[model samples]
Target: MSSSPTEVSGGGVFQDVHIFSQNVNCNYAHVDYVLENLKDSVDVLFFQEPPWRTIRQTVSIALVESDIVMGAPRYPDWLYMVRPPTDECNPCVIAYVHRCLAHLCPSMQWDIIDHWDIFVLSLFTPKGAVNFLNIYSDNAHTAINLLSQEVNMLPAFIYMGGDFNCHSKVWDPAHTLYPLVAQHLLEFASDVRLEWAHSSNPGLTHTLHNPDLASSVIDLVFMGPLSMLSDLPRLDLNCCGPLDHVPISTLVPISEFEIRISRMVILRKSPEESGFLIDITTGLWALNVEDLFSPDTIEVATSAVAEVFSLAWNAHAKEVVITACSKS
Candidate 1:
């Protein structure tokens, strides 16, 4: 249904693809809670202020080998931690892509761009690719300008999820009605073709369970090509253990069947185009009867199957040229 890229869809009921982002103050004393609660619930988990120094303690827990574990080499096998892990003052980000979809997120690599305030984790998806950016910016102004450039050079589907530390009405509905420095963030999201996505359930993401310190929406997700993401529910499990920010999660309805499809196929369905069905019917009709009825060899059956699918597909989709890879 999308013009540029395919829209993520399901058969009326969409399977949720949960993405969790939390600013866990360094030395995440509550890392155990994450292991227990979020271990099987979400597809991806992003944590800021991860326990880089105390990561070695995770070796005590049990985890699968396929899990892309990171953090300290001696740490838990929960996630692939932010590289060059530093202290809380130089806060870093950590991400754990579940083994189930980890293979789909191939070509994972760390990229350091000059003058940019973000740490990028370029990850690929089946249809195309996405940049799972983990940004920590002291000054959002410079970050906004630099991120604009970085996203321009990259492909579509960017999940710039992190603790932006910027406060404004644009993202924080509770932050003062008028924002001074936060307007630049809106411009940044616009420039990068991303839109703010956060939890609908109220309660700020920062400084949770603290009456003295006021909480604000510091953590955020700026994603692109709308409708790809669904509801974001703020998890108020404040007492979950050493977290300063209450975790925010978004539910993305996913279909494994759809994940296996090519992007070209999703974009091929357009209602405005006329003669699409006619073209499909003609193409299938033009197929050789000898090929479809051979019935003996697998090749002939494959051709028949392809033709039958073409007819069915033509009923709802337009004719599109699909490319296949050739191995040497």
Candidate 2:
């Protein structure tokens, strides 16, 4: 999974969506480092074997003591999308979308594909809701088998990637033997109209810690036939950072009409913030609380207060465009 990073030309003019995928090996520190460093550059992140632990405890009605709240790590700049475990098994696949793309209305499609190792994320666009899949198949190929079984029911994902943990000549030229698991994996992908995306820096996607063992290419990414990708995926060998698998990323073009690089926001401690505070204070002062006779009246007053806040925000928020370097 370790390869050197090579500088390639940027994506096409309309290719604004950047996707980064990696296997963190369930390490908290590795996951934290990836999100912290790539938050500014990457639009979406697909992680396999992400750390799932108890973040805190909350009051539980079932038990006398507090219940353990187990989950993945959280970052302010990235919206973490993960499906809760149905039983005791922790989910192996998770995704994160940048806060900048909140307008896209990204959501997890648990109803479509509900599995701990497979995650389906849908991003709403003007054209339609496009889905991306993140998966982690163990040596037994449980996730791949499930996908193959549910091929008819699953959505046509535009982008699908993860660590399949299977070696075949299709993805690894060094591996001459084609195993049964590889055949099933390829067949499943073909049924769903997914094609293998070759990496620019081609090499082993998984490495051994010891010098004696040979490395292998198991982690793979497959893109749907209709995906609007701009270039071949890149294997970032330099950024694996204490992980066995290197990071792979690709750029996808957004529709010209939907390409938005700037957004309006009221920065904290700025003049706009001061004005917003003043306007909110004034609006709250004028709020009519006298009509609290019924629940309907209370709802009306709440709506009025919300409208006032929205008006004030729209009035003072400044429009800021994302810099080109930030997308790099």
Candidate 3:
């Protein structure tokens, strides 16, 4: 399923969104393997820790051939990629929005803070536990301090997802780190309101040297709000190649279905809350009812409505509805 970026064009801009993250070295064969697997599903990709020259070539290849978009590093750490024909354009952060969303894309400017030998992709502004701050934090307390300082400067909604290089007990008290990097992460997430996304996954990332204890979840996806993650499925495909650790992939959908599910849960918890009702109303208004009945519409709406009822329906309301329907 390999596709060059040049092969995409449509009546409406591509709306189905996909993201891929890989750490391809100079081995063009590995790059080819990754592109083959991703060409069909992903419109945007984020490759971390690749050689600077290789990243440049990948971007050039994507730009010339595929309708896909690529974000190569201008400096050292971060690169944002996207598929084309969309209107959103940010030089610092690559954005590939559907042409339909071109009007909604905001023109925001990003200022480079610092660059390191190891590439880092900053996911979000710091809030609390769910905020993701991707960095290669060494097993030193000083590294934790540096991360803390950086996270403190971001907004609350930021989600940090990527390699942190530190999985000490301090972050995962159940597990232990030699110097307590885990604790640092815990404190960092607590201060900002970010929670680890794949906390439930049992697999560890660093596999080569520590194969016996190779099940540490070092690479992470942190979220500012748990509500932001409607579904968190881990991709454990055996595509690590020569690398010890396999790549991790997660799905994040900014769809009405996801929004409705979150809204319904809130409404069910506090049915009397004005804010909950208002949110439900707003979500319903934003939803395309016509699409709900369309043959082409996926089952997303049905599940979304069911989830809302599951969260919001009171025992009395459920009984009443059942009785009314039976009588009718």
The per-model lDDT (C-alpha) reads 0.51, 0.75, 0.40
Q: Least accurate stretch of 10 residues (summed lDDT) in model 1?
A: 319-328
Q: Which candidate should be chosen as best, given lDDT against the real structure?
A: 2
- Which is the better candidate, 1 or 3, if ranked by TM-score? 1
List the candidate 1 regions with Cα displacement exceeding 4 Å. 1-16, 54-79, 85-91, 112-117, 139-145, 148-151, 177-180, 208-210, 236-240, 253-328
* Clash number by candidate, in order: 7, 4, 39
Off by over 4 Å in 3: 1-19, 22-28, 54-112, 117-134, 138-144, 170-174, 177-179, 199-201, 209-215, 227-229, 255-328
What ranking emerges by TM-score with the best candidate at the front?
2, 1, 3
* lDDT of candidate 1 over 238-267, digit per residue (tens): 434656767666554333312121221213
Cα deviation of 189 in candidate 1 (Å)? 1.5
Instruction: Check candidate 1 and list the clashing pairs.
Output: 15-254, 17-252, 55-75, 58-76, 70-79, 70-81, 199-232
Q: Write the per-residue lDDT of candidate 2 for residues 1-328, one digit (tens) a residue.
A: 1111112225422234678889998899888888888876788889999899999999999899999878888999989988787777888999988887777787888888788899988766665566678989998999988986676465555677889988888888888666656766776676455688888778888887888987899888887544535567788887789887888887654443222234355666889999999999999999889979996777577667767876897899776653211221
What TM-score does candidate 1 reach? 0.58
Q: Ranking under lDDT, best-scoring first?
A: 2, 1, 3
